[model samples]
Target: MKKIFIITGEYSGDMHAGRVAEILKQKNPDIEIEGIGGENLKKARAKIYCDHSKMSGFGFSIKMALDHIALEKKVADYLLNSYKPDLVLLIDYGTFNLRVAKRLKGSGIKVFHYIPPQVWASRKWRIKGIKKYVDEVLCIFPFEIEMYQKEGINVHYCGHPLIKQLPEKADREQFFAKHGLDTTRPLVSIFPGSRTIELRFLANTFIKSAKQLQKKHPEIQFCISHAPNLSDDIFDKYINGTDFKVIKGENQALLSISDSLILASGTVALEAALYQIPMIIGYKGPWILYLAYLLVRCIKKVSLPNIITGEDIVPELIQAKFNTENICYETEKNLYNKEYRIGFIKALGMVKEKLSDKYSAEEVANEIIKAL
Candidate 1:
């Protein structure tokens, strides 16, 4: 059996890698695996060299520079000399993955990039880096394939991994009963983010917005879904005096019961769409990090739902737009207005159509088998 080394950066990447690898394994059970990942991939039986928590953060690479460099060199050297897999699969961990890609450029191991970096957004030059290193790039977005192809990279549009995870019409009663939530009252869910920096920037703002809503309508219930990467103390600190409950890592369940959501932009927004919940997406990167957004013109949209459907299905309040007042305003619109709810659900249905029914893991597994 040939060995395949899988590399992932954070929780979402780990989750994506785990699903893809599982599907690939099902298709070819004889292939052996090894590399860096987290709990999900570990459960999938990938021999993880390192867990992703040491490198999880938004913005500057300088924040985790020393540790990032250490891990990068460690993982890269390991793949190059230790396991020496037949193929090296790089998931989205822009800085480190690129470094690993560079080191393995001429090592004879076929470099397959599963989730390409956001070069279209900030580091277009990274395509130059990718072209020099990666042999085949599998992209989730159809647009990405064209972009990388334009840059002379062998790219494939594999479709997004999220489309396969769709649940049957959400069982609201069962969900509520399981979580012990009241169905009669309006449910509002808050997701600050999985990172500590995101919690610092948006947690207070979310709490303030929730408090304002609670003041006006005591009948409303505010629920927070804590990203497992972050601690419960983070949310507790901000919501100490307020009447709110934090549901650790139960983002999906919390969103299912929600009439509306206040969440950080990215994967969670996509999840919200699947649940058919009216949502307001918000994000805040440091000032210097925010400048990176302009440097990378490739990122057209921040919300996953919008990117997948090629249109804004829900309001994305990024950077300056991500404030207490803005969140409250959008929440009010989505919750009280009949038109907003109707329009959002209609857009969500279209997003669902754009995605493949076959699981992402299954599709990605097929790609790996064919590549080998």
Candidate 2:
């Protein structure tokens, strides 16, 4: 039986990796799969070597950094000497995965990277390491193919897996009734992100902003889309006494029924765009990290949807700019201004067109099998 090892660093990566694992199993039932991932991979029948929850959060402290390094080394050594997977599939988590790639460079094991890091956003210099270590790169974004190929790295543009995984739109009336939401009110969804650090930095601000907006537009109902990875207590602390509805693991339902979204600038922003929902992307982090980002970031836009279109379709407010005032201002513009909303939605249609239509999980799975 062929053995494949997968490694993912976070919740989103784990979800994408799990889909690929499921497809791979369908193609070759006898293949043995093991990985360092989360519940998603477990559901896909991949043996859990290491739960990726251990490596959560945005930036690691010194102790965390040291501990993760030790853990990664131990896992790498075990996989190399004992498990000896025929192919090592890496999904995002660039820093650790890049190191893993370098370690396995001449080990006679094929290394394939799915959803390669955002080298174009910042640290374009990492292209050297990627070119040297990664045998083949399966990219989800169309623009990423040119960037990787320009550097002479073997790469393929598989359509975004999210396109396939995107949930069907629920009946708005039934969804509202089921959630006990006021059907007459315009709904606004809020996505603060899945990571603990992200919620810690932005959840309170999001709540405060929503309250401000509510005072102005009393008929607008607010809903917070809670990530499954986070405990209810974390979100409860922010919206405890507020009127906002906390919707857990129902991003599609929430996005589908909402008029606009106030979201953290990441994959969720792109997901919101996919739904054709107008959104204001907001982000905040440790000041030092923010400063470092400003210094290193090569791109002007931070949101994936805006980056893909090469235009500011949705407004972005980061760091000091990501305050309650700015959030309300942007949300108000999207909600009340019919002309602006229509133009933004039209631009999003073009953004969707730029992404490939190939089923990413199947394409990636086929490539992995061929490599094996």
Candidate 3:
């Protein structure tokens, strides 16, 4: 039996890696897959080396950072001495996976990177590390191929996994009734973020923004696309007295029916574009961290829809600009301005077209099999 090792760090990365695992298994029944990932990969039947739930965070403290470094080293030692897999697949989670790549360097083990590090986003210097360590890179975006190839890295544009994963739209009336939402009013969805750190910084702001928008347009109904990993108390702390309905595990269905959305910048922005939902993207962090990020960020725009289209198709309010007033203004524009909303939605079609219709997971699996 052929053995393959995969590594991913966050929820989105785990989800993408799981799809690839499913495709790989279907193509070759004798293959054995193991990985350091989350529940999604576990469900796909990849033997878990380490559950990523304990591994995810942004800007870790001294002790946490040291612990993660130790953990990465432990996994690397295990893979090198015991597992000795035929192929190593590294998905996102740039910092840890890049270190793993370094450890496996020149071991004659094929290292295939799915959704490789966003070196183009920032830290362009990491491309050198990627080129030196990874054997091949499977990219999701069309433009990423040229960027990686320019640095002489072998790369393939596998389109986006979300293209296949986007769920069908639910019946509007039934969806509203089932969620106990107001059917008569225009609906606005809020996606604060999936991480606890993100919620800590932005959830109260989202609630305040929603309340402000509701006061102005009393006929507008507010709801939250809550992440399943987070506790209900996290949301209740901010929305206890508010009328916002928290919808769990139904992001696509909610996006399909929303009139507009107030969201944090992440993969959900791309999903909003896929659903053609008019939205305002917002992000906030500690002042010191925001300052440091602004200093290093190479791109002007943060939202995925805007980055994909290479234009500001949707409004982004980040750092100091991410206030309740700005959120309300943008949401109001998306909800009330027909021309603005229509134009934005039309631009999203071009963004969707750029993603193409290729089955990303299957294509990635084919590459892995050929490499093996």
Candidate No. with top lDDT: 2
Question: What are the TM-scores, per candidate, against the unseen true structure?
Answer: 0.92, 0.97, 0.96
Q: Which residue pairs show collisions in model 3? A: none
lDDT of 3 by residue, 137-191 (tens): 9999998989988889999989898898888777889998998877888999998
Pairs that collide, model 1? 120-298, 121-296, 121-299, 122-296
Candidate 3 wrong stretches, greater than 4 Å = 57-59, 233-241
lDDT of 1 at 205: 83
User: How many steric clashes does model 1 contain?
Assistant: 4
RMSD values for the candidates in order, in angstroms, are 2.2, 1.4, 1.4
Task: Give the deviation of candidate 3 from the true structure as CA RMSD.
Answer: 1.4
lDDT of 1 at 365: 76
lDDT per residue as tens, model 2, 86-137:
9999998999898888888788888999988898999888889999999999
* TM-score of candidate 2 versus the correct structure, residues matched by position: 0.97
